[model samples]
Structures are given as structure tokens and as C-alpha cells.
Target: MTDTDLDQSYSAVCEALAQVGEARAPMLLAMLCLSLMSRFERADQVLPLIANALAQSDEGDADGR
Candidate 1:
């Protein structure tokens, strides 16, 4: 999928999470992570990319960028 498709899918997931409420947020995140993990042939290879992306996002949010 293209970046736009990924962004839309992410937004849709956020909307679904909102509908499910904050109390279930952790469970939902865990379920989503595990579901994604199941598809990886070499999780180690992709984990650094995921970690870097998350770190960048966190930094951007912190800096209000």
C-alpha cells in the first residue's frame, strides 16, 4: 500500500479505538501489535524500522512539529 493508504488505515484504526473507548485502548493496541507481528518473517529486521518511526513520531509530537 502507498503511504496515503497506510495513513488512512491508521486513521480508521484510531477512529475504531475511539469508539471502543479509552478503557480498552491498551488491549486493542496489544491485539493490533500481535496481529501485525504474526505476518513478519523476520521481526528483528523490521523492528528497528518500527522503533525508529515511533521515536521520530514521539519527537515530532514533543516538539509540536
Candidate 2:
């Protein structure tokens, strides 16, 4: 997809997550992650990528990246 499409898609996801609210967002996010992971041929390989992304997000919050 093009950059615009990606940007829009990410924005849409954020909006949807907001609608789910803080209390239920994490559960919904986990369900979405599992649904996406199930689509891959090597789902196991995706775990590390998810972990890395999460680590980066945590670091971003910690260091104000």
C-alpha cells in the first residue's frame, strides 16, 4: 500500500481503538493481534516482531522518543 493508505489505515485503527475505550482496548487489541497472527504461514515468527514493536513503544514512552 502507499504511504497515504498506510497513514489512513493506522488512523482508522486508532479511532476504532478509541471507540473501544481504555477499559476494553487491551482485550480488543489482543484479539486483533491473534486474528492477524493466525493469517501468517509462520505465526511463531511474528511474535518477535510484536515483542520488538512493543519494546519500541515502551522505550518511546520512557525516553519521549
Model 1: clashing residue pairs? none
lDDT of each: 0.90, 0.90
For model 1, residues 1-65, the per-residue Cα lDDT tens digits are 99999999999899989988999988998898788878889979679978998999999999999
Model 2 TM-score, all chains together: 0.74
Find the 10 residues in a row with the least total lDDT in model 2: 35-44
Q: Against the true structure, what is every candidate's RMSD? A: 2.8, 2.2
Highest TM-score model number = 2
On residues 1-65, what C-alpha lDDT tens digit does candidate 2 reach at each position? 89999999899889989999999999988998898788888957898988999899999999977
Q: What is the lDDT of candidate 2?
A: 0.90
